[model samples]
Target: MLDAGICNYVAISYGHSGLWGGGMRQLLFNTRPSEACFGHFGAVGRYALAAQRGMHEFSSGPETWKHIAMGQRKWANLNPAAIMHAKPMSEADYHGAPLVVEPFRLFDSCQMNDGGRAIIVTSAERARDLKHRPVLIMGMGQHNPSNEIAQARYLAGPTGAHKAGRAAFAMAGIGLDDVDACQIYDCFTYTVEITMQEYGFFGRGEGENWFQGGTIEPGGTMPVNTSGGQLSEAYFMGLTPIAEAVMQLMGRCGPRQLGPETRTREPQVILCSDNGGALQSHSCLIFGRG
Candidate 1:
């Protein structure tokens, strides 16, 4: 369309009924006798098991996942639109939750939600005259290691985020120190941990320390998922993070806005991530104030 100048804008819209419509259960697994012999586990169980086995090298145990869960839950409390806004979570509440898989608790997994989100894409000059201030896209990169998660060599550590983040930052011409906030895709708490490690937010195998003491929570050194993320907010897949980043850069987030007063620094630059196919596919986008 841009080639012919038929349209200068593109709109992306998505909606899913994986939660209330009952699509979540039968989508990834079945209870047939033959399938049951291997495992009747669904996406949650399968991903949880994979993460448990794959993350053993960096994580000491399942306890570390709580930090990610509780941190995002805190952000949810600040967002009235978040599904879990009214329900606050504490360390005790997290640990007391029953395990869906061996190492993942109810809080550690994202709540399947039926939600829709839409975004508009246009040229920088066009956006300047739009309704809101333009949110500039600084850089974007993608790295898909493998289509099959089980076959991915870096399934546990150094995910596709490693190369993808490097490319995005290099394209942006900025270092990690310039990043003010993050919008990490959090289908599961462990997803955030692994992605951030590979993004070079901290040293490899040091997530247990980097995630502690509210580092990624609201008002922390690096605020992440200020919209509460897919874990506490609504699950719109990759769009959840992208939408939040757009709102934040435009200074449209009401209660969970990241400003110099609310966060360690004003959100001049933001980082967003989207993961697909069991972390085998990764995409990074760097956004800056426009």
Candidate 2:
């Protein structure tokens, strides 16, 4: 587009400014999700809990969420402005937390805090002229299904990442093996676990083993959500993950930086996913250092 004399740059931003203070309660009440609703349409807590519980046969166990909480909390310590920065978490704390809904502890839920985030798009030529090292957007893909919760196939519907991720990989001219890190849109701990699989980070139904040995933690084989994400970081829909990906590619994430364990090194390619409407809308982007 820049070559065609179109726009020079594009910026995408989102704000849950309503979460700034008393506004959080407003979100819970105003969204009008039913208490009995499941999946994306009901009260956030009850729905996410119920959906995961019904699929117990695929359970990754409590430790799955525990690691997610632990890793994200560690990143929180690195982020002075993270909502959970002042509150550290431990495995004991996760185990002790009361269940807000069956199969879901309080720590599993995302923090509903006020926040804003943005991403910028520009041509490679303009990027070179710009001050900061540009994070190249190598690939993009999206897919959305209109099925309602009641009408959708259980555990079989395309929450879309399958199609999106495949398309993204195709467009990027790379395969999943090339991705070194991920910035998943984690509205809940399970969101991270499930999405990683759908995006082809590992074989289907292998999350239990795939996540073992700190693979998703800092300095691990494949780092994920290094900013703590919606679980321990502020939630602003998908923008937080998008911004974190930009920072990761830019080598701007301070203590939470990934790649090499003891030192800061940027990944050559990172995959970021954005989800919406009860996992109905999906978009995947691959960013790289050029």
Candidate 3:
């Protein structure tokens, strides 16, 4: 595509000016919206309905939020570009903080802020010739279940990420167990927990157990979102997370870099995910050392 377009680089980026709404914006706005916000999927009632359908109940969801928050904070310190890099937080602060929705503390909800992120995409041949080490896009996939949460087939689970991940893995010729690190979507801390489970990184209903002992921490077996993700990093509609993935794969993250796993073992694969619309749509990407 780049060759055909006569373009050497293509940039993928997303920016939000949530506070900006001119007259043109109001003109397109509907007084009665027909669609539900993606947040509806993460709401408590949906979780309850999912439990009723025998999907593993997220009873321990709150506990997992703490680990994510703390783990993200630990890395935020190393990311100079992160917004929360200076604001340290601990499990105490997470629990003591007010709840956004029951079971979801304030820390669990991603804040809306003005931000922008960009990344350039080029042909593999062109990338290889570049001065810096290139981050290879091994495989990618996308899936959509429905536009409306009301039409979701499996409210208890089934975020469509599994299908996306499976397709990407097949294309990458890898397995879920083979992913060494992840930059999964973290619109809400629970999003990360659910994604890890749906993608088979952690056994169902075992998020809390897996996170214990810093399994997802820096240098841990399954380090995740090492750039603080949307939780602490500026949320750019998943663009920032994608950028972080490329950085980590290129081994350019100075302090936020994964611990030297090479002493005992070497990791050359990393996975990244982006979600759309109440978990109804998704995409996954795999990076490899080439």
Candidate 4:
């Protein structure tokens, strides 16, 4: 999502409206049938629960479980700033934690904190002169499913994420295999798990396995949520993933840097995902070094 309200207005107008008058009105007043018209809440946990319940049926096997736990551990390790940090946990820890919602727990829920981030977008040439090298916005896509979750056909699949990924890959002229790392919005653990599958990072039911074996850590095959994410990092209206993707591309991530040793190359390509309102809505963005 755009950081400012004005950005939404500009997007609704397809960059055609004047600076502050008609565009703003069209965006704020118009009730157009667009993805931008819908919104939702409780994104992370609910999706995880739904995935576990076989509501969407991608993959929820032992491998998937292990990957998810491993990713959580890695996130805890890299993010000393995280609330769950220093609390050694294991598969047993996840299983034993009191259930907040079936298949989720207090720890499974994302941390709530206060923080702010800012980003500047310009041409790749101009980006070089800024504080850091500009990571090009090679591809970006956003989507919304039916607003009423009850009517949604696949709870686990997240049709919106699937569609968004396809659009992003098409726009960037890349594919899932091309991304070196990812920064998925993990308002809840399941959000990440489900996204892994929906974005084509893994086979339908294989996302959980991707999370296992430390696949999503700094040194793993496809490091994800490198900034601690909403799971361990602060929550800022769901824009944190966008900022993290920008940082990863700039090579400015300090403690959570995912260097070449982890994935055999600097993270030249990244995929970022976001979910809105109980996983009711989804968005994906792709970035790369030009």
In TM-score terms, which candidate is top? Answer: 1
What are the per-model C-alpha RMSD values against the true structure? 2.1, 2.9, 4.2, 8.7
Evaluate model 1: give its TM-score: 0.93
Model 4 poorest 10 in a row by lDDT: 9-18
| lDDT (C-alpha, whole model) for all candidates | 0.83, 0.74, 0.72, 0.66
Q: Which residue pairs show collisions in model 3? A: 50-156
TM-score of 3: 0.85
- The order by descending lDDT is 1, 2, 3, 4
Task: At residue 232, give the lDDT of candidate 4.
Answer: 63
How accurate locally is residue 167 in candidate 3, as Cα lDDT from 0 to 100?
Answer: 91
User: Which of 3 and 4 is ahead in lDDT?
Assistant: 3
- C-alpha lDDT of residue 20 in model 4: 43
Total clashing residue pairs per candidate?
Answer: 0, 0, 1, 12
lDDT of 2 at 224: 82
lDDT of 4 by residue, 1-290 (tens): 34533333121111222234464344323443442345312333345446576533654643454455446556656566665567656777666667664565655666554345566665555557767677888887888886765567767765689888899999999887899888887766667777777787777766654566667765677777776676666554456677777777777766666675345348889898877755677778888876
Winner of 2 and 4 under TM-score: 2
Candidate 2, which segments miss by more than 4 Å at Cα? 1-4, 20-27, 30-50, 154-158, 261-265
What lDDT tens digits, residue by residue, belong to model 3 across residues 78-176? Answer: 789888889989778988998655556678766556768898899888989977678888889888888665677855456778888889999999887
TM-score of every candidate relative to the true structure: 0.93, 0.88, 0.85, 0.77
